[model samples]
Target: MKINIPETDQERIVIVGGGFGGLTLARKLAKSNYQIVLIDRNNFHQFQPLFYQVAMAGLEPSSILFPLRKTFHRYDNVYIRVAEVTGIKLAEKRLETSLGICNFDHLIIATGADTNFFGNQQIADKAIPMKSVSEALFLRNTILNDYEIALSTTDFDDRQGYIDIVIVGGGPTGVEVAGALAEMRKNVLPKDYPELDCSEIDIYLVQSSPQLLKGMSEAASEKALEFLTELGVKVILNNRVVSYDGEFVEMKDGSRIQSRKVIWAAGITGSLIPGLPEGSVTYGNRLKVNRYNEVEGVDNVYALGDIAYMEEEEYPQGHPQVAQVAIQQAKQLADNFKKRAAGKEMKEFSYRDLGSMATIGRRLAVVDLPNWKFQGTFAWFVWLFVHLFAILGSRNKLVVFINWVWNYLFYDQSLRLIIRTGAPWKKMDDVIDEGERG
Candidate 1:
C-alpha cells in the first residue's frame, strides 16, 4: 500500500502518536515549510489528565477528545492519518504502518507510554488499565456492570466481590480514582442502590511506597493521604500487590483484598515501536535521546514525551514522564527546526519544572509549586483551573466546567448509563479481545 500521502517539495516530517508531544509539534510546524504527517492509533487528541472523571462517570469521553483531522483543517501542509506505526525502518527512512509504508525526511516519534504491570502476567491479563478513552470507558462500564450484578445476585460473598475495588498505585491516577469512587459511594451509590449495603462496598488504594505521590513533596503526600482517609478510602501503604487472580488480590504481607475489579495505575513503560536498535532503549523501555531529542544510534529520527529518555545534569536518569515535559520538548524541537531553517545554531532542550497537583475529591487536593505549596479547597480549585486551562478546545472546557457545575450543585454524576453489550464480567479475556477488535 502507498499510505496515500502525496509527494511534496517541502521536507516531509512524519510524527507518530497524536498525544501531547505530537500535537504540539504539529501545530508549531503548521506554517513552516514542512509537509507534516501525523499518525496514531486513534484520530483524536485526548486530554488524559481528566480521564479519571470519565471513568468515574463525572464526565463523558467525547468532552475530552478532539478529532485529529478537524484539528488540522486550517493547515494546508498538515495531513492526519488514523493508523498505527508498527515499526520503523530507519535505514530506509520509512515507517511500517497499519495502512502501508510511509517514507519521511525527518521522523519524530511521540508514541506515549502504556500501563506497566511490572512482569506480573496474572495482573496484566486481569487488571484494567486507564490509559485511553476506551480503557476509561471500559473501566466505567465494568464498575457500573459490577454494581448491576451485585444488585441482582443472591450469593452474599459473590455480591461483595462485585462491589469491592482494589486500585493499585498511589500516584495521582490511583488517588484520583480512589477519591472518585469514594465520592460515588458516599453520594451516588446509596441513592442508586438503596438495597445494597454501601458500607461493605470497600475501596482500597494500595501503594508500594511509604507515601502517596512519590515525586511530590512530603507535605503534599501527607495531605493527599489525609484527604483520602477523610473520604473513607483505605490507604494501604508500604505494601506491594504480589498477585491477582481475577477474584482476589494478595499482598506481599500475606493480606488479601476480595475484589473482582482491579485498577492498575502503578507504573508506565514506553510504548516503543519494534525494530529500533536494542541499545537505544534504556530503563522503562524508553528511547535514549540526546539533549536535542535525537534518538541515540539513529539519524534524522527524534523522540519526545514519555517515550524519550534524555539524561541531563539536573535529571540524571531522565526527565519525569509527564505531559508538561512532552509539551515543552515539542516546543523546543519546533523552535530548533525553525532555527535550522534559518541557518542558526540549534539549541539543546531543558525542562522547566511547573510543579504538580492531584485532586483527592471535592474540595480536597494538594498542589506543589516551586514557589508555593498549598492544599485544601483552594488547592482543589487551583487543580481544576490548571486542568481546565490545559484542555484542548474552548468548547471542551465549557462542557467540562458545566459538568462540574451540575455535579457540584446536585452531588451527582449524570453519565452513569451502562450501554455496553458484551460477554459476562467473568470473561475478562473475552472483553479484552472485544476491545482490541473495536
Candidate 2:
C-alpha cells in the first residue's frame, strides 16, 4: 500500500530521502503552488544527532524517530512515499523507485550520507555503523548480546572480548558513543553484571587526528578528551586503524585490540544513487553542484544535504556535512523555487555557520557558537535544549526528556534487552574465534 499525494497540474517537485534537508524543504514549501512528493527508504524521519543515545540505551529508537506522514498531514500539496530510489534518469526527468517509475519537473536528491569504509569490504561487512535506526537497533542488540555472552562464559579472556568496545573514529558520534559506553561501565554495568568485574569493560576512542572534535574549537576538544578520560575511556589520538576482522581491530602501528563490539563512526561519504555522471562526483563522494544547488551538467536535477557539494569562496571545500547547512540550503532552495515559479530573480545559496556542539554525558558537553565557546554543565544544557527543540515531534521530545531525566537521576539505563529475531550462532562463533586468535 502507498500513501497517495494529490498531484495537481502544477510543477511536481520530487525529493529523494526524507532526511533533515528534504524534510525542511518540504515543510517550507507547504501551502506553496508546487506539488511535493517526498520518497524515503523508511516512513519515519530520524533525528540523527541523537542516534548514540538510542544505541547506548539512554533513549528508545522510537523517541528519536517520527513518522513522515504525521509531519505533512496538514499540507495538502505534500506527499510521502515509502520506497527506495534506485536510480535517477535525469535525461527523462524521471526516477526509478521500488514502487515504479515516477516523473518529476524538478528532482531534489537529499539522500544524505552513509558510513565510508574506504574500500575495506571486510570492515563494511563486520563492523556496526550507527547511521540509521536499524543499524542503531543492531548495535543496541549487539552490545546487550555481548554482556549476555559474558554472563555465560567462565573464561576470563573470552569475557574480556565481550566487554571491550573499541570505537573507530573520534568524531562527534564516536566520542558520544564512547562516553555513553563509559557511563554504562561506571554506573549501569556493575549493577547489571555484579558477578563480573565492571573494570574489565574497556571503552576506547580511536582517532587519526591529533585531537578529538577536529571540527570544533581547541577548548572543546580538550574538554571532551578530558571528560572522556575521566569516564575511563582510553582516548587514542593520531592513530590509524589499518584493519578489522569482525573481532580484532588492527592498528597501523601493528597493534591489535580484541573487541566484539567495534563501532565504526570514523568517516562518511555521500550516499550516491545511481544514474548520475560518474565523473561529476567530487570529494566525500558528493555530487558537484552549482551555486543554485543544481547538479553539474544536469539542468532539472538538483542535490542537497550530504549528497551535494557546493564549492563557494567561503566554503572552498564545500559546506560541512551538518544538519544546519542542509536545513539552510533547503530553505534557500525552496525560496528559489518560489521565485522561479513567479518569474522573479533567483538567489544564490549561502550557508550561515551556526557553529557545532557535542554532548559527552550527563552534565558534560561542549558548544562552539559564533562569538562564544563554552564547556561543561551550561554547554550541556544548551546542547539538550537545542536538540530537544530541533526534534520533529512533541511526543518524541517528551519521551526523550523523561528518559534523559530518569537516566540522570538514577544513573541507570533500562533498555538492555537482547531480543534476537534469529540465532546468529555461526556469526558469533566466527567473531569469537577471530578475537581469540588475535
lDDT of 2 by residue, 301-366 (tens): 889999999988989999999999889999999999989989999999988998899999879999
Taken over the whole model, the C-alpha lDDT of each candidate is 0.92, 0.88
Question: Could you tell me the lDDT of residue 362 within candidate 1?
Answer: 94
The window of 10 residues in a row where model 1 has the poorest summed lDDT is 429-438
Give one digit per residue, the lDDT tens place, for model 1 in 116-209.
Answer: 9999999998889999999898899889878987898889889989899999999999999999999999999999999898988899999998
Which stretches of candidate 1 lie above 4 Å from their native place? 421-438
Best by TM-score: 1
| List of clashing residue pairs for candidate 2 | none
For all predictions, the C-alpha RMSD in Å is 2.4, 3.0
Give the RMSD in angstroms, all C-alphas superposed, for model 2. 3.0
What's model 1's overall lDDT?
A: 0.92
